[model samples]
Target chain A: MERKRASLKFLVTVMSNQAASTPAALKHTPLNATHRELSAKMVDFGGWDMPVNYGSQIEEHHVVRTGCGLFDVSHMLPLDIKGANVRAFLKRLVANNVDKLQVSGKALYSCMLNEAGGVIDDLIIYFMDESWFRLVVNAGTAEKDLAWMEKMNADWDMGLTLTPRRDLAMIAIQGPNATQALNHALPGVDSITAHLKPFNAAAMGEMFIARTGYTGEDGYEVMVLAKSAPFFWKALMEAGGKPIGLGARDTLRLEAGMNLYGQDMDETTSPLESGLAWTVDMKTERDFVGRAALEKSEITQQLVGLLLLDKGVLRGHQKVLTKHGEGEITSGTFSPTMQQSIALARIPLGIAPGEEVEVEIRDKKLKAKVVKYPFVRNGKVLI
Target chain B: MSIPADLKYTPSHEWVRVEADGTLTVGITHHAQDLLGDMVFIENPATGRSLAKGEECAVVESVKAASDVYAPVAGEVISANADVESSPEAINKDAYSAWMFKLKPANAADVAGLMDAAAYQKLVESEAH
Candidate 1:
């Protein structure tokens, strides 16, 4: 009502987070050698020197959308928590219910939280068993998540070992032909991962195969020994996996309507207002970290999916206006699948999925329609 | 890729070919298409639209991001390439040949102010360093 929109207090974390940005103690995945061979443009992302692009990023995007593109996602940290009461500790540590992950190897996407109910990070937790759980969190949040988990694990008397798997590297091969490429790339991998359902994972020695991805496609997020990453990458490339960059990775995930940990929702925002209300199980009696804050607070706005019908691309931090109120785009991009611009905006409630809103692109306000997120999936347009 | 020796260029990265008809064909240079990545959508000025030098007359969106193509000189759009809008990737495939629009220059002599391919090549090289 006052002014409809502004950047959700993300700057505080990004600003105060001047934690030694130096290259000290930095590590690399095995693909680091292969990326150099391809002459990639490397940049420091969350302390890992990763390739931003090989050469042509747009072509790489198309390669993934139309065929297959492989991404070096080893920067994301995987933490394995073990010992008894692991499930009980996680139920209190995260905003999402751990009870939903009843089946073995089933993964649940959730937001890790601090005591104040603010999001510490968003992660995917694989429920392997009562004694074991694995969490894949953002690269930037690795240190913070480990610290938080360690302190809490000790405080709660949970005999959990928060082991960071530095020995591992991850590769995400996504697009229409994703599954086929991976199946053919790694010898004996298909037989193990051939029947894996969505969000299901299987471990084969040092390699862990998960049928999940940020891209709106049927793909595998394969984690393997850091030493074997280069060989696997080469094999996958020879088997027809075109190497993609972080640029395409952003577009792919944006089009897929997935929330980036820091960009879309952070410590200042709640899962309810961040379009992740469905991920929170209010129906269950279980009380998680952020439950009280979410329960007591009056949610003023909600996150929604948008499709730009105008001539410009919608970008993050851009303002969104509706008759109900104004909001801001958290993540936006020109969708390869839709061939139009799309975004995820936090707008006031009552702006339902079929409504129209205006996005301030440059100086002009362009029309955009609120649609269900996930502009594409499995090479098909859903919006 | 080598920049052609004869064509004129702009900092925004469009290449202009002056024809005997005093008309000009404009397209983004190879360097631009390479930097921008896979072309997905293109919007050119209408045939009759008048534009000032440095005005945004066309828009090009790659899989990575969107960029504006400016009118290199004051001119009236004489023709627009519809084929490019239909198959935007053609620009990435061959940027020089995928001409975006044609313009009848406000003054044919103003082309002298733009960079020749040799100078533009040096500009591109310097920017890279």
Candidate 2:
């Protein structure tokens, strides 16, 4: 297993080297030049040239947990669906209940699934009005999601107009000091955002601000015109927001127990086994995509959190040995806030929290304990 | 970034420093630490363990991923650095000073065949492109 892991690493290195040689083929975000100006280390993330870190990824992770950090999430696609039947179209498209979003500026987290109950993507849907609803989808799956939604619109005769908002840029300001820094950056905007609850959004002309974030902290995901992203980023920095790269963003989300779209659940995995069952609405009588398959499928595996008791760091794709059967880690990392290794693993059922499991890291089988996740939130360790 | 003139380096990014006691100190190069980002965990080879040339004898894991540290030459591990195990960020601070282990070369002539600072710098530059 150790040798296999080494060979896989070598293959990845070769692929990345090839990608570096042809830089023009990679996509760049709106803040690409800004990241370069900050001397960030760039890497090819799903065909997009993204900043992994400026310097010391661990330090950047700490800054987000303790203070304020800003992230450029412009790679994610924010789509607008318009027409008279927008809400009806969404009810049949997503697995979650769209009726729950009765109030304007409310958001619902849901999984768009294939007919076989496999997740195509997990997205946040923002309801603006009966005829206008906005959705934020993953960057890597943007094109596929649009095609699927278009096909559904035509087949269902919803006659909705789906517009992919590529002309906009998104920035997430996160941490305990997030509100204070944002208020300082954009004066008087606090009056609209201060009362915004979690999973709620508010629109100020073309600019949209949502009180939602991947990191488990008080923050906002603000959207603006693509041309003004650099200026907004600079203002946020002047207001005491540190530039955080994707590396720290990853650790923070993992510590928060948030599921990364591709890493945690892909097109081959179902929401029932990916710790997203709550997001899937089965109590309603409304017919939606993938509902029939979900009802028929028997769940044999479950996603659980693993805390390494040994010294080595946990990593994805490592074998997990439980008493029931073998399992695999979906997302794993060294938690900067907890100062320990934590992982989300898809293990066999019947393994409860606090049970012991052996994770195969290289040549050694290290001891780990199953625990409820959200390992760290608001700079506090939960387990 | 800093490839000391007095030290030798391997293509895999391990740096070697010859000591007055005839033993050699082994650690990763500055360029290696810079590429790997922040170090969070390290595992060194056991003392007295014999290693072949280019053998994967140690590990240096950053927060992002884990990387294998190869033995620079055929040697036996003399001692491992306990301080680095407890606080791996020392390597990120100064890769040269925070040596991972001490090795006694099986053949002293092997150290002479290693690349000098100028050659290692050229190799790093080539890899960057």
Candidate 3:
């Protein structure tokens, strides 16, 4: 059931439902029952029966903005890196400078590469130690990610170990009072996660609490044991945390100008063009996978944020018109906080910030301005 | 779920109200808004544009996804609720009050063709099973 160089493997047991194994019928988080109890609108996201919204997505979007909302992100995959020379192996595997990981609980977001410049998956590497690092990857590409990591490990002379922790579940509580909500729900969590800054993680026995999230708000991403997931979720909800779904998640991330993995970029595209040039540390001397490919490649287009001027919503796969050339909108949404439509598009490199372009939305070419991303950060709308 | 008995409905989940001025006020039903989750952006048909019965006239994009708001009957667009365009969430707050647009019927006969509120309610119930 295990193969070399593969980072993901589903211990596929003979399930009665064949469709369940397919992406269309993916598994649900432990909180599915709780979500259904709250009358959440359920949708099939990458095969999982995930909640899109609990009644009103816009209101839930505001909850995360003004208050706190909890999301069941257990569908994401977490891989543990262990064994001798694990740090050395990762330096060759990821695009970012892993050597910069100096602290024990620091987290670094980087793109895993395929050696050909294409992105395998954008992930967060928690620098625990020299012998051990942890990676949390997207749910849809977990299988392929595991396979690639295993294959890369096989070629190395150093002893390495990779383990996917599927028995755990992840939940994120994001908002201004996110930490307080968790502290209220579970006793003693305040001291464990109180002083933790953004992009840092702390381990409290069975729970791995990371102060990181897709939403542009102060939050904690907790990875807990599967058996304890339902209890923790219920406790959070009882402690004033709204059980938010994927619907609010999409809006919150969009308002923050963060990119969705599959929608923004995939294995077929490169980080240089996917609004993630900052994640790729090319200035450092440390060579990584796909570093050579990126050095040789010509970046024809760059990802730029779009602010819709007309009365229309910008959406993905929509055609974009610019003076240099045509491009496509990678991700877009009606920002709840900004109360307007915004998007991120792959346009010609010459489309400078503050430049105006047109986006083809619903057969109408609406005007929009190109701007720097992170539209809303830390509860403030910059653009 | 407030299904106004004064207005008629289409199986596609749009509601139509016949005004004394001979124009029909159109809006998505409460059930429709509930199903769509959260209203975000709406694009009503342009004024003076003619639409056939069951025509795709307007678009209602909820945060969940985008869906077409079918014209309940054939008509010429007379007026659009521009305010809803700016604050689409109003529909979720009060679906009946937040009419998307108003239309002058090309054929008043098509108004008789739509299902009454009670009949429309039955259709909504039947869709579940």
lDDT of 2 by residue, A1-383 (tens): 34534421343344347435565788888899999899888888888888888898999999999899999999999999999999899999999999999999999999999999999999999999999999999999999999999999999999999999999999999999999999999978889877999999999877999999999988999999999899999999999999999999999999999999988999899999999999999998989999999999999999999999999999999999999999999999998888899999999999999999999998899999999988888889899
CA-lDDT, candidates in order: 0.82, 0.91, 0.83
TM-score of each: 0.85, 0.97, 0.90
After superposing all C-alphas onto the true structure, candidate 1 shows an RMSD in angstroms of: 5.7
lDDT of 1 by residue, A137-198 (tens): 99998998899899998888987888999889999988778878887887788786668998
Q: Please provide the root mean square deviation of candidate 2 (C-alpha atoms, Å).
A: 1.6
RMSD of each: 5.7, 1.6, 7.0
- Candidate number achieving the greatest lDDT relative to the actual structure: 2
Model 2 chain B: weakest 10-residue lDDT segment is B120-129
Maximum-DockQ candidate = 2
Instruction: Decide which is better by DockQ, 1 or 2.
Output: 2
Q: After superposition, how far is residue A356 of candidate 3 from its true place, in Å?
A: 0.9
Which of the CAPRI classes, incorrect, acceptable, medium or high, describes model 1?
A: incorrect
Per-residue lDDT for A211 in model 1?
Answer: 88
Shift in Å, residue A225, candidate 3: 0.9
